[model samples]
Target: MKVAASMNRIDVNEVSKPEPDPVLVVERVSMKFNLGEQSVTAVDDVSFSVRPGEVFTVIGPSGCGKSTLFNIIGGLLGHYEGEVRIDGSKIAGSHESIGMVFQEESTFPWRNVIDNVAFPLELKGMGKSERLDRARHFIDMVGLSGFERHMPAQLSGGMRQRVAIARTLAYEPRILLMDEPFAALDEQTKLLLGEKVMEIQQRLKQTTLLITHNLSEAVQLSDRILIMTYRPGRVKRILDIKLDRPRTADVVGSEAFGRYVAEIWADLREEATRGMSDAESARR
Candidate 1:
């Protein structure tokens, strides 16, 4: 699909350093949901914008409205309080040009990998042959070249996630939204997949917003990390990650990287502890 090409064209030299353009802007966004006698506020007064070709991350403790924020931005939930704009256009109830990948196993058990990857294309009434051809390229892009015929049951957790990512990338949206896509995997798999995902993002330079709880992950994969406070989430701080590109485990061990991680960790530790206490109180 030619749309894929438009989303992937980024100058390598301009990737690690992106010029200013608001690809996705969230302004005075807040979310409140009612559950019978009580109301729960998930996000409160949150505002930020993802610059073009930048990996912007939102991190917070569990139930701090990070996922809720993502849902609003993806146009999956319209019941929220404020505005989410994609390329300056409001996306309150639209999913026309944004790609999304979630933490769950999104693969279809009944469909083969090729068909699963091509499902989105098929939904748009694309021809089978053309969809298959496009799916094949994305399949290889995510490093699942030989497993095109495999079903969901035949692949590992990492492989399944790869398929999900490939499926999202095939359509090539203006912004890619990911919600802890590697959290369910083992540490090794998560790290490896994170690296692969970062590489692909670097090459494509697509505007991305990733929601994560892992401090190191937020540091390693993002150009800037937006730390959120406890429930009724708000931006605590936006820490810039200045580590060199093609980030690896080696970078994590560097002195400068350690300092950067420590800075973000200092902000997150207290918020995370508060979140735990809140969960315990809710359980009681």
Candidate 2:
């Protein structure tokens, strides 16, 4: 079994922060799937941790099991090797402390923004009026105060994603797991939404584990990034992004930011090539 290092080396920028105990921890996690008369390993001996109030990102090539590891951490996949923990307790299934925002627009088409954001609260037996009030605060946090009455179908893709985020925030989870939450949007929209996510993250000091393919987005939003190897993904490197916090879209232009991006891309290039080759072979 393999485990990621407790201390990550800095890349590009050479600053360090004191290490705190992890809010989320994965120990020697490995997941496998069985096909008809065949078996495949998706994630192999992966280990990492997310500190409180920091954005910890996972990045890798297409077939690198980033999503597989993410689902495992989210408790969406209950059967896997090794163990996962949040706030000290081991997870067997979906735990209330962990929340997920998927790549898909997850807002219910039938529910309006307030109703959608309040759904989780309602599930907890909070009164309708009180839940709506709580929902409104999260909706406002995502900058959707005026769209409280709008249904998912009535909003743009980005707006619907915002609604999904607000809905997750309504429950006030201790840890947030986002799997390519802004993946479907165009570049400009992704950047803008990323800014909104950063704003909400800073405000709430939410401990987040984000899975993304966009290096620029990772550089802009992450405090540290864990790069994975191709197929049967394992930790290849962990790069501490020593950029100033409370970041925005404008930060992408800085020399430090560009260096981080370049450094990560260099690390990913060969692994991505191997992934592409595997993809072609599988298609044959």
Model 2: weakest 10-residue lDDT segment is 10-19
Across 1-284, the per-residue lDDT of candidate 2 in tens digits comes to 01113234744212122236788878889998898888888898877778899999999988899999888888788789998877767888888988899998799998899999999999999998899899999999999989999888889999999999998989899888899999989999999999999999999999988998889999989999999888888888788888787899999989888878888888899999999998889899
Best by lDDT: 2
For candidate 2, the clash count comes to 0
lDDT of each residue in 88-122, candidate 1, tens digit only? 67775757678999988998888888988998898
Report how far residue 125 has shifted in candidate 2, in Å: 0.5
Locate the minimum summed-lDDT window of 10 residues in model 1. Answer: 3-12
Cα deviation of 204, candidate 2, in Å: 0.6
- The Cα error of candidate 2 at residue 213, in Å, is 1.1
User: How does each model score on lDDT?
Assistant: 0.83, 0.86
Candidate with top TM-score is 2
